[model samples]
Target chain A: MMPEKVTIADVARRANVSRQTVSNVLNSPDLVREETRERVRQAVEELGYRVNQAARRMRTGRSRLLAVRIEQTQDGMNVFDRFLHGLTESAAKAGYRVILYSADDDRSEIATFDDLLGAYEPDAFVLTGTHYGDVRTSWLAERGLAFVTFGRPWGMPEGGDHPWVDVDGAAGTAAATRHLLDAGHRRIGFIGWPEGSGVGDDRRSGWVRALGEDAEDSEAGVLERRTDGSAAEGEAAARELIAAGATALVCVSDSVALGAMQAGPVPVIGFDDTPVAAAIGLTSLSQPLSEAAVRCVRVLTRLLEDDSPDKPDHVLLRPSLVIRRTA
Target chain B: MMPEKVTIADVARRANVSRQTVSNVLNSPDLVREETRERVRQAVEELGYRVNQAARRMRTGRSRLLAVRIEQTQDGMNVFDRFLHGLTESAAKAGYRVILYSADDDRSEIATFDDLLGAYEPDAFVLTGTHYGDVRTSWLAERGLAFVTFGRPWGMPEGGDHPWVDVDGAAGTAAATRHLLDAGHRRIGFIGWPEGSGVGDDRRSGWVRALGEDAEDSEAGVLERRTDGSAAEGEAAARELIAAGATALVCVSDSVALGAMQAGPVPVIGFDDTPVAAAIGLTSLSQPLSEAAVRCVRVLTRLLEDDSPDKPDHVLLRPSLVIRRTA
Candidate 1:
């Protein structure tokens, strides 16, 4: 956070020493008398010295910068754009500036983290795109760096010791499934990305759970199809599912849902509720992205401030479905 | 930019003075002789000095931060998202961290600029969304602030004495209109936003230019419709144009073009080549945002470095047309 600057005179007055002693204690701690140096350090702490006050140079590092990676934009996706706007708004409210860095993968992200630490010494990092066994979290934890993620640690229960925020994909898909089931569609087909990724698996489970005991999950599995996340793939898969007697569909993303809707309009629902979904009137689920971004910043601010006992370690928010003509 | 750390010993050697002298000159310049102080200041200048250096305490304000406002995301628009990603990428490559700030209007933007200057002392500002008689540019200029804009200052040719990089909306719309004219559509209609904004007016001019003298300007003027930028508005306008004997349509934005395409399929061409356009096979124009962002950062970086007489003060880039089934 942008902690206010504590002037040399303020620190000197607090320590009952001259301004020169405070300057000496900062630029050259060795020149000050032993007792005076200790008194000056305490005064600096009590005064809330921030900004590049690491002029306790090489000690008490604070730069009021919050670092996060800006991923390259993907076709048919604007989720990151919404999240960044909310994040920058939230971070600014807390008096912290967010600095962006780029990386192609986890390895490079860690390397970039190392570079940022040496150059800007950002106060903390806000990580996104969390997955199982993500090394970025462990790397920061091992270094004892103050950081928080915008995604839950996939393999761990509630991000273990670190803090995180996640939008519940299962909750979204389950809602979509129930919506179709209530409309008298017994055989609701689920179209999603190939399994293995945490998000893919999480969304697939929702459809299965919503189908309940009457709908058989083991009957040839013809109502389920896992494919790449593209409109073409979605259209192909939907055609096959329709041939298999499916009367409704739940898609993992708007892109897929767009294609699925074109494959004969069988009450298709999508996730992420992108602009395309709104423009075309596709029923879809939307993540509470603004809320998630605010929570991510607030939680990290508390961690950096060492405000204990009250802050929760993790937050899991539900996704809401926006109904339109397609459903 | 990120200038490297220069230790006291390095400054001492450069000034041919003892390390203690350099320390005294930095922490308490009053204790050092007048000539020695000048010599130290010269040494500080002759070599690269990073931010948070001793010169900072001497009021030579340098924080190596580049401030830019991040606007809230708008429905059916991803143009800013592409531009920001490019700007941050280019800025980081030039060794500057971009800090985000927000304001609802010009007055608040100026106020935010004042607040940022006091807190972070950002090295410079990069402005966007420039419009007719935009007061922000003059405000920054009056203070002798180092800044650049991503939009040309409307009402001023080539942004006058200031530096700017703008996408040529006229060039883009002209290309779109020519594409339709080449297809033998003599009665081509144009749908755009209500006039006043430089971008809207510029785009409208292109369609007029492409029609040439053969298209009567004094007729009913039924070949053109200016409406709000939305798909529904576009469709309504397209319907009117079609009923008035228009054979094809050119839209100012993809959102409007999408609606026009639905108003009875007359080979629609839209601007911004958005994901929705690609998904539905709508022909459109797309700005070279990455190139524009790079030029903006490069020009600003040169300005910060005081490398004048070489860097161009203005850059205007052309948009490319992407053909699909619609055209």
Candidate 2:
């Protein structure tokens, strides 16, 4: 059960004034006579009249609420928290508030969007964790809804105009690979997610680009294994790679690198440089998620306000390798 | 460069009707005749009229927004994310939306609360991560704001009426200690934050309660070391406790337990059972945070609606010990 909402009419009736007078008192208090203002204020206090945002939106046309979907992950190492921090901070700087919507999967996410649009009508939305065949992108795009994603539309046809800003996964692995190569470890092994994972494949391509054809052929020279990015899985994969004569490891995530640490003294490099990496002193690549979040908000703001000097449809940012004791 | 808001008057003028008729078209469309409805709909489409929540709030007092503060931690292993997940899921089930406010410290947080109250006027607030000497509690309480905290108002004087839901931290460590004891471990050590940390002291008390006074007297028998709960610091403290003849360890957090893991395989227990714990297979205590979140939202909803059966001022929850390979 909810409280009884005391509307402006209630305040007006209590103050013995017209509804327009009460509206003027709220929107432009100075425009009303001092005695009228005092009477309206007293009535509001007596009735506990709080301005309803639904009524306010009918006049202002702006909810001033930015909606962002957060998908809960089994792994607590999710970077969305940082991304959210960046988004809220930036949104607040622009005089907008953020609404957090939780959707476990695509269907629920579409429902969330529908519910938000029908009820709250957020000014705009920011999407995260986009992948190939992500239907959410198309859902918003078809509706002509203003939104910006933290990940690029991976499988979209070239020159599609959906706005997005993404950290270059390949660039991250390429940097890690080059770092390992520069360390004079030619027999480098890579641990990542199973193939066909868009992000994972991009990261693997970076390693192959660094190691040449030998890194491509599973039987030729590249020592590679894929798992679910768990520490135990990483350990098992690392042992196999080590037995195959790899002197260094390049993992897709800090979780895998942590597992690889158990496979001997071979140096390992990881991506995402999550808190786990800091705990164990593992060298890892840190995605510029905060910067990417800022970028996404900027693009969304532009799409919402339509006053920016220039709008970019997509942006790809490079990740920075944070060297620690691991590599 | 915001778009100009199309008003009810504009729609009415275009439809050659009174503003009240336009309102009727929106709120009670059935009251309008079919031809008038078609005319109003055409005017609305021609004018691109969107509902203004500000105007609607004057007629119906509901924003349906719940504000929650999210402080950005240095580490991505932020517990607030999990808390948000639970809060949003439950709030949505109740047909409410959540607004995320990001602030660095108490001052900014209070300012954020002020801004939101003046602007959107959310129905209620769910406070998380309360600390010693927190001023937000008093601030909100003094203003008679409808809110509930995720942490108990520790150190508050008797009969504090503000609602709060907190996990019994001592229960978590006590369970861990009892489990370790059952595993035939007599000499157990404690790794926690520095003295005077309310949560840390509570957890340490659980260990002392189980092990007796000798466990409280560092100079006599108990082996304890305090640090900033970093992996490196955990490693140093763990090594010292191990050198002092302790065979098992209970840490304040999973991060510390991770550092403790580096000090040899002595079966360390951690708090928070974070993703890192699952990845590394460290046995840890799992706070029923999701349940706690649901309870907090339920209480806050009651406070806001002012209609619930016998609302309590404080609710304490129990945590469970998750046994993993590390222990």
Candidate 3:
């Protein structure tokens, strides 16, 4: 059995204030005098009065909940879990809660958005697993909804208005390539996803960019073998690359690297630095998720507060190389 | 620019009904005549009049959201993700959304519960990673708040009313031990956590029970080695078990099993069938997380609807043995 709910009237009577003053204390405390606010706050505490959620929402349209989508890839990387760990921790510290929603397709996602907005009124949204022609961006942008994406908006060029935070995959592989070059390995091949995939392409670009003078050796037609980014494929591709005279490899993901290592271990680097990589001592690039998450919260808070910068800024976080025995 | 919100007045005009009739259509359509209800609903769709959330909530007192906490263990496992995937999918299908919250300690969890209840009023909660002396059970119970736990209520015995759903860890290990026995392995060792942990102890029990006729041959004092459940410790334990003349090993977790496999491939079985196990061809027990998640949703929904079983029934789901090369 629940105890009878203590009301604003009860708090008002305890504090010798009007019901309106109590309402103001709960809603916009700034509008209440400091002395009155203190009195009302104490009354609320002494009475254990819970602010009526429905009434509070009607008065101030803030839900203080941030919605994020859950996505899983076939190969099963734990990047989303790590990102969420950071996202939830950071969002909580900034005084917001996270809500998760899943929809099968773009149309369902929009429907879910409409349902949530109409019902819960989440303060903003965070989109994950972003890809080219992600309808969510255009839909949210059209509605002027506050949101941030984990992936770079591949459809848009640099400096567009919508906020996004993506790990620089190109920079990560470039660092790996440069490291191999410094170690005196001339021929470094990149094993990545097929062409036209945004993140995969970005990672491959980093490898080519790092080659500079050795660009001819790193061309896609010659050294690059793009599979669906699996461990088996990584191993097969590594064998082909080794036969083709590549001395070192920079695979797109840890699973691929695991496969490459199995084929032959000739100084291979992987991305994501998953547990398997660490267990096997594979050097890989690690996304600074916690730092990026903190920045995401800051940007989202700014957006929520309507204190965003003059121009919408998209943030790109750098991935650091975790050098292990393999690299 | 924001689109103009469709008003009840517009819906009322479109439906050619009084504003009160339109309000009745949204809040308590059963009170209105069927013909009038259909007219109002059609108007609502045509005019796109979103029912005022605050008014609807005040009438129904249901947020249609379920709360769950996120906890990470020393060894990273994606069980939570699988569980959440099942949960969100099930809940969404049942017309509910999930809210994720993080709290480091019990006190903070209760504080968060109070905050969420006061602010958003989630319909119910799903508690994960429950442990001994979990105050959350009693705290939520005292408030008469609806909830379900993923782990069995450790302190409680059979016939408790508080709803809980736990994976049958003992059954999983027992199955592993039986499989080893059937494969002509007489001496099987168990690697588990130190005694007194509810889950670890339960897993150990399964191995001993399966040893039935030869239980003395696989006593904890001899064949069983308890560690902190680390891969390195698992490797060390496997060595000790091997020296003790154990032909096969049953591990409490995939991390420990991975280590055992590294020590020597003596046909090992692991639990949780994590990605590592699959990649390395280590046969492991896979928890039926999706099934558990569906049951959890069904139970929580029943609790929310006040249609729970006569006595709070704690459900235990079985884990399936995923056979691979290692076993």
Candidate 4:
């Protein structure tokens, strides 16, 4: 037989507190005194009291659901899935639920955001693949919604206090460059996205910083930025770099690195130590995406639960470089 | 300024039908006559009437939502993600919403299914990672739930009528074997999972069928079956096969193939041409996961909208072999 369902009233009676007080302790602990909150929590756990999700939702007028907005450009891209796994695992641990929202290219970002907000009224929002001057972020900020973005904010102030978690692209690239440099590679070529993009720029800066001004200015350390994020671009960049006598190439992404490898036998390194990177033995950086995703969810949930509008928290995580045969 | 909100009453009045009829036309077309449904649909498009999701949800006992049940064990695995992306995309195109329900291994599957069904009362359901003698499928069938699964029913009669979309695993493995044979590999090795599992056994059968009975029995064609699905197990199998004088190895999955590749320089082929397989240049049979997922959602949605329990439709997509350096 199934175990009997436990209710909050059981704990409230045991703790000698009103049902409302028990509710306050669970929903908004800030409203209750620390000692009272501790007593209620202990009683609840002791009684195995589970808050009735439906009743709680009705009382608070807020669903314990968070929205994860993903772009639906590519039909079968699994990159978002990896991040989602991390987010779901973390959210489950914290007793939160995730609802997926797909952003279509044809729809205005604001329209999409409004549709989701109106339909779900999600407690908090997590966004991915945001671009420069994204209206969605600004709108959420203006509405005082608790939210966090996975990518670095574009056009935002440097070191801006915004709730976000991203791969340390610059640092990862620097480590990649240092690895090649230590491997007796002086003529290292860089294949990256066009300048002015947040991730592309960050990775490019890391390469330049590691190489120094002398190498940056010299023909030995040429940087070729791709106009688009595609393997074809990487192949072209590799051909040019090879013609320019580059012994080693560092690509901005695993796909690009793979393309460069396919174009020629020149040893190449890539970012995002994606599954492909590991399979091909391409020396690359593995971003701690799952960890970052978990952290983002945790921080955002805390903000939503506390209703804290305090200074935003920004987290930076170090990405590890996996050495493969490519470089 | 945003356009004035269009109401359902306006559409109903314009179509000269009762508001409830209009609602039925939108939500359950099977309940409305074809002529009346066309008139209501035309009125809706004319007025640009988009359902006020929150308002409609409040008025109706049902939600315009469906739940995709995913096992927690397969959370980070990319294979599930590919199917999810396809399912989500197709569901969105049909103006339906999907919520993910993570199933806990510790909980009784029936209890978990009951909880989700009672809470969400979703219009339809999609189950992932279904196995032989799946109690959930039988229970759902008994309850007459509009549901679909990812694979053919195991422990059930052949040609069992069910709404499902499955990849041609046997044909895919045969193609992989033929590719290696065409590449001048006469002494080939086969590494697969234990013979009872549906997917693993199908792949192994295909490999055996591709190599005639005489060739299959010969010392040149070695077969190694591992009870566990792990890289270490695959590596061990590969080592044994290599010692037996095999030149090429075909694995049941990409992970197993990658593991076998790590054992030595023997050409390795895998199934499910996953992202990892693509990354490492492992020649594999690429299952049409996204298409299968989309089709599953489409079929399940049809089942929900159509009140009559029509004969189940089955879709089996042919898997394509991806040629890479490994083969």
Which candidate leads in DockQ? 3
Q: Please write out the lDDT profile of model 2 over residues A44-141, one tens digit for every residue.
A: 88887766555567666567788988668777765778778888888888767899888888888988777677557788889887777888987887
Point to the candidate with the largest TM-score: 3
Ten-residue segment with the worst summed lDDT in candidate 4 chain A? A70-79
User: What is candidate 3's lDDT per residue for A242-313, written digit by digit as tens?
Assistant: 998889999999999989988786999999977667666789999888787888888899988867666665
Candidate 4 RMSD to the correct structure: 5.5
Give a tens-digit lDDT track for model 4, residues A207-289: 87788833534553445656476777788888888888788888888888877997788779888766666655788888887
Which pairs clash (backbone N, Cα, C closer than 3 Å) in model 1? none
Give the C-alpha miss distance for residue B140 in model 1, angstroms. 0.8
Off by over 4 Å in 1: A1-60, A156-160, A213-220, A309-312, B1-60, B157-160, B213-221, B310-312
lDDT of 2 by residue, B192-262 (tens): 99887788888888887777633443442358889998878998999999999889999998888888999
lDDT of 1 by residue, B54-80 (tens): 234335556567888988767746588
Predictions in order: lDDT: 0.82, 0.81, 0.84, 0.74
Q: Could you list the chain B TM-scores for each candidate?
A: 0.80, 0.80, 0.90, 0.83
Itemize residue pairs with steric clashes in candidate 3.
none
As for candidate 4, its clashing pairs are A276-B279
TM-score of each: 0.83, 0.81, 0.93, 0.79
lDDT of 4 by residue, B1-327 (tens): 333556789999999999999999987899999999999999988887777654565455345566775444331224776667677777777777676666565246566566554444466778766667677777777776678888877667554456878888888877777777887787778898876788888778777777763354455334555647666788899999888878888889887887898889998988887777766667888888779977887787678666655679788898998889887
Q: In model 2 chain A, where is the ten-residue run with the lowest total lDDT?
A: A213-222
Whichever of 1 and 3 has more DockQ, that candidate is 3
Question: For every model in order, what is the number of clashing pairs?
Answer: 0, 16, 0, 1
Give candidate 3's whole-model lDDT: 0.84
